[model samples]
Target: MGSYRWNWPILLADPYYGWIVSGFGNTCLIAVLAWSIAFPLGSAIGIARTTELRPLRLVGTIYVEVFRNIPLLAQMFLWYFVVPELLPQDWGHWVKRDMPYPQFLTSVLCLGLYTASRVAEQVRSGLEAIPRGQHHAGLAMGLTPAQVYRYVRLPVAYRIIIPSLTSDFLGVFKNSSLALTIGVLELTSQARQIEEYTFAAFEAFATATLLYCAVTGIVILAMRQVERRTRIPGTIAIGAQ
Candidate 1:
């Protein structure tokens, strides 16, 4: 323990600090892009699962089952390596050669799709939790099924599931660290590099841990505010009326 010297100064220095900042930026960008893809795709699939159409429901169920069952690391590898090869020769070549930042793009798609499965389940659960009479009431008002979903079901379902979605959003950011394995130099990767060069494993990892906690804390706080504001009167039972 006496041999260990913590150097916070190095993290604040010129080139090393720059690397950390760049990694943080990449992490944020990937998380945001992945969420953008996951939320809409997941919502659509979730809605489809609840619909009367057999084909649509089957499609949604299959997508959720397939993606959720597969390990995310395996999905990342498949997207980065195998998927491109499975494409047409020209497209494969383009993905392998002409595409800029292919690793980043691949990570985004893999993370997005993988997380979408979980999000779909949450959305489905939220929708199902709503009273069945609401659906009938919406239909009784002369609204088309689509209109009922748009106006009534989705809005309330989304409000009910905000907490779960917030957790998923946080998970997406944390999971972005997996991109390091596929050559995207996000924060965890940078932290590894710091340890390699500086041989200060504790310092490197500790800083990374703190950064992760900070980001997650901010998300938790922000989402709590949203949850409070959007909370429905009787959706979540509190002891009293």
Candidate 2:
């Protein structure tokens, strides 16, 4: 360690800086895209798990169990390598070769599905946290079960789970680093590339560490604001905080 020289400026120098910037952008983009898929789908699955409908609950349970149990790295590999081959031959070929941004798209899908299972659980906890009286009151007012959820339950449940959802949102950003495995060229990938080119492993990764910390820190602060603003008085969400 005493003999090693640190070239911190290399990170801010030509090409390397650009790589960092674009990689950060890609990471953010992938997280946002995956969250788009995760939120609504996970909400539906969570609602299903709570519904009186047996088949819906069964299907939702299977989905959550299968996805949540599988390792995310394995899922990433399967989406990029195996899923394409499973399609019709021509379609497979297109997916593997002709498709634009295949790695990026695959990363988005893999992260989305993997994260949705966890989000479903958060939503379920949120739903269950609601007092039974609310559901009963809605029903007594002639609201269908679906209408009750659509109005009273869902709105309150979402607010109740804001902190949990914030955690999941942060997880998406961190998990996006795995996209580098399939060549999405996200932040981690760029840091590695910089290491390869300049042999400044410490500097490259140090910068990356700082950038990741900054981004996640910002996310935490922003989410806290959202949680505070959306928080319902006398709720478990606040009590837990």
Candidate 3:
């Protein structure tokens, strides 16, 4: 411990700092893009799972089960490597050789599809937690099945599941670190690079740990505010009571 030089200033200065900052930005960009894809896709699948249509429900169930059961790292590799090969030969070569930012694009798609499975389960749970009578009432009021879901069901269900969704959102940010495995150079990867260059593993990882905490802390506070604003009165959250 005595010989370990604490050179945070060195780490914070010049090309090193720039690399870490760039990596942080990439992490954020990947997480946001992935969540953008996951949310709507998950919502649709969740709704499908709850619908009376068996075929639609089966499709939704299969999607959620297959994605959720598979490991994320495996999915990432599949998206980056196997998927392009599975495409037509011309397209495969294009993706492998000509596609810009292939790793980044593959990371976004992999993370989005992987996270969508968990989000789908949360959404399905939220929708199903609503009283059965609510559905009947919506129908009785002359609303079409679609309208009942669009205007009546989804809004309430979303409110009920905001807390769970918040967790999923944070999960996206944390999981973005896994992009390092495929050469995205996200924060974790950058930290490793810094350690290699500077021999300051402690400083590198400590800085990363603080940045992660800061980001997730902000998310937690923001989500809490959303929960406060959107929470329904007299209704318990899914796991409570």
User: What C-alpha lDDT do the candidate models reach, one value each?
Assistant: 0.91, 0.91, 0.92
lDDT of 2 at 197: 97
After superposing candidate 1, which stretches have Cα over 4 Å from the reference? 237-241
Off by over 4 Å in 3: 236-241
lDDT, model 2, position 127: 94
TM-score, per-candidate, Cα-based: 0.96, 0.95, 0.96
- Cα lDDT tens digits, model 1, 159-186, are 8889889989999999999999899999
TM-score of 3: 0.96
Which of the two candidates, 1 or 3, achieves a greater lDDT against the reference? 3
Q: Write candidate 3's Cα lDDT for 82-142 as tens digits.
A: 9997999999999999999999999999999988998999999999999989999999999
Better of 1 and 2 by TM-score: 1
Can you give the lDDT of residue 74 in candidate 3? 92
